[model samples]
Target: MMKVPKGKTVLVKGVASIKGECEVLGARLNFFECEKFVPVFCIEDCEIEINGEFRILDGSTIPESWKKLAKMDWETVFLYGGVDSGKSTLAAYLANKVGGAYVLDLDIGQADIANPGAMGYGFAKDVVSLSKVSMINGFFVGSITPQGREAKCLQGVARLWKELRRLDGRKIVDTTGWVKGRGAKEYKLAKLEIIEPDLIASFEGKPFDWKTFEVEKGYVIRRDKIDRAKARFESYQKFLRGARILELERDRINLKPDLFRGKDVTQFIESVLGV
Candidate 1:
């Protein structure tokens, strides 16, 4: 049985590019200009209240223990970095700092939490239940398969954003760095525009030359090598027009497993989160 959120109207952002409906609940959804959907359901039979005032729940800080901090104004934060740039470390650290902010593991293709064949459920799982967290592990889409998994993953992310907006805490989105930091595909790019968090914090040691790429049907396409080399001022004009950008500098770390051997991830967490 599908659960329809009750009362106060579930406000969805952006509009869907395609026409669709909630298969289980049978709610009609409309596609808006930006290709997003705002689906609202009337859950008259359920006891769950859809009011805006709900508390976040992650074990780092209980909702009851910190009413003042928990009730503070919430902001959605995004942690993005190339492979091995410590995006997850930063996300966990920040989530811990804010007490009970939600942490979504958006690295679905290369997931580390809340996926099959992993060890015990980790902090990521608890974060989803008690906070505004959604889809902590990357979606299950095999690169070699002929399936439509990538498209589904994109929809999943959009749905997650809609759900997160309903909760009362901050949102921390963890992104994947597929193919050397480029996003996975066109679908991922579409979802990015829809989620549109308050902050997009990029962690990279090397100075980012935004003009080195061009947007071709949503994906960032590399420019001609020689042309890029000689350019004095490159234009990341397309991305700049779409959203604000924030870059963070940290000691460069590679995604290679061996280099990070025996490192205490918790210590990294403390460095970012601070006690």
Candidate 2:
């Protein structure tokens, strides 16, 4: 419980002891711990050493670059990076900075603008959680994964890219950390071809055939850190907490039409409930 005066930078070692916005002079962080539901780090021995006049700690590897990019007429901006590379944070930051832009999150697995198993497009009006705006247009992939579902995932991106064309602003496509091997490269190439963004930003790994900008750092947001699984579990439960329940008549919707073909599986429902 110490005051980090303005203009005085603070040093943090991935601890919860420090709070308030200060330029990250340096930080070593990890997304998740090996344990199932453990905290990301132990902050008991952490310390924040301040120096000089307090200043807004918003400096990043691409602050000026983002400013310049935001001023440009690039209608569609694409971001590619590895895991925990701050892709979502950058998209949200740039969407707010650029103004009048919609962030179309294509990271179905680690989705920001939507739940874990869906693609979503929404505007980043404020610094709120991206999930708050996840309801704009959610395309489900039926699984909390994107490894073998590249087709559906890319289709989601391409479909939403078309939907973005209906809007009157820029589009920021935040991608996943699927830039590992040959198949992934090909899949990403397909995504690039579908979106055909005017500008590409890469925080890590190389993406081909575009007017690309390389951002070395800004790989993680400095505000909050948590365990990945814990965060997902919380989000999953939060999503279903107040979910709407629907009741339909038995004849109103077919319960697996194929499964009941040439048979009367519904006989059980009829015999038991006599619906």
Candidate 3:
């Protein structure tokens, strides 16, 4: 454990435990370990016991633009950025600052509130990572990336947006990093149309013709494809822990992309195998 003087800031990238009067992006910091770096500002003298890596900076590493964005009074905010552009980080920061804000996480690939193949939202009062926030509910897209499954993903977003609109509080939407090419553009625009955010915090310039706040990429660590896959696998395991299977009548439940819609192939398969 090392002593952190008041007014000093420590940027921790991995597992660590901070004790004392300190805050991370307006939220009290106690313990944090996530895929991105978290800045811990000492309100008073504190002790931080780190397990992975840390950097003691002159002051907070949080960008001034982020600070300004947090102060803005907007009912709904959408974060737009590419991979590792700090969308999730900004979402967590703004949620903590605003207090009792709803975080609608739509990054199905690296989902925080739900598994990798789903989108979810949760209430955030104070959180270092959205993954720590309990999921209120989620819509399964059945895929990690929104490549060919764009329509399903958009449908899920629209369904979730309907529910979020009923809630009476600040809402922050974090999106995926698939901001490229015509297809990606169309998908993103469709999402924006559904959400109708009051403000769009564009981290990578103006991607669309909307009211946007050009924000800079703050301190962030980029993860490779292997790292991303590992994280997703771990998330899948965590989400499936203590799981159970249930049998229900087909007529009683609705299934997406019902496989039995086509002609039955059981007899053909049996003939081919001579069973």
Candidate 4:
């Protein structure tokens, strides 16, 4: 049975997209701009408090451990979840909170920092919309979904992180909202192995069972729910407005299983673009 009681205790399992207004017992979910409460949940022994009161989780995408890490000079953070889960919003928020950091956006579609069908990496100098963060480099994933492009996505993620690791301050990987099926799970787990980030934080949805890493799930109440088409269009518009074009140097790119092992960079780019 679904959650019947609405005092504060809500037992959410499977997948439930919140349409009307809803609240979590002790979740501080005021850090997003769109419909972000939708959850693709898997309940085991997971139990939440039901105080029937409003309290602040302190508006953080990370768990309490993040606070201690924040006091340090820097760290590597990864924010991941399904669509409308506020992954991008929280990542941007933390980037600003952490003073400065290198943000690597792995969302192929509706990417916050680069054009669709690619992964972008750059340094966040200040708190701003993801589109405003100029992309220092990118790797083409060739497809919006990582079904056939799983290898490409993994390579892109590893390459981007390696290329940007030299930058000072915290490092962040803003992953896609593609946590649905078996393929998605395998792809994310594989990608995480390559990323090996210090912190593996997820938004409202936690699909993978990577218990060893112990994902930190954050909750938020999203007001707007934008689809992929709109998100992509909006992101592109932002990039076109003031983003200065920058070229990717081949030597800087680090792909373990090079997609273009025998092909030149131009050929690889053209192939990925399907041109």
In order, what lDDT does every prediction score? 0.39, 0.60, 0.86, 0.59
Q: Model 2: per-residue lDDT, tens digit, 210-262?
A: 78887654424443345665666666786789889898898887666454343
Candidate 1 achieves a global lDDT of 0.39
Best by lDDT: 3
Q: Report the CA-based lDDT of candidate 3 relative to the real structure.
A: 0.86
- In model 4, which regions exceed 4 Å deviation? 1-74, 204-227, 237-275
Candidate 3 residue 48 Cα shift, in angstroms, is: 1.5
* Candidate 3 per-residue C-alpha lDDT over 46-146 given as tens digits, one digit per residue, 9 for 90 to 100: 99998877888777767888889999978999999999999988898888887769999999999989899999999987787888889998999998899
lDDT rank order: 3, 2, 4, 1
Displacement of the residue 247 alpha carbon in candidate 4, Å: 22
Q: How far does residue 248 in candidate 3 sit from its true spot (Å)? A: 10
| Pairs clashing within candidate 3 | none
Residues 114-179, candidate 1, lDDT per residue (tens digit)?
342111112332221211233333334433221245444554565566666677767767766552
How many angstroms is residue 83 displaced in model 4 relative to the true structure, after the best TM-score fit? 1.6
- State the RMSD for candidate 1: 20.6
In candidate 3, how many Å is residue 144 off?
Answer: 1.5
Task: Record all residue pairs in model 2 with backbone atoms less than 3 Å apart, i.e. clashing.
Answer: 6-53, 6-54, 6-55, 7-53, 7-54, 7-55, 8-53, 8-54, 23-57
What are the per-residue Cα lDDT tens digits for candidate 4 across 1-275?
Answer: 23332233233322333322433222223122222222222222223333222232222234453344345443776676777676665666567666667789888876767788888987765433566578999988767777787666766876787778777667878888888788887777777777677666765434455422323444545434455577676666755697688999999998698454554545554444445
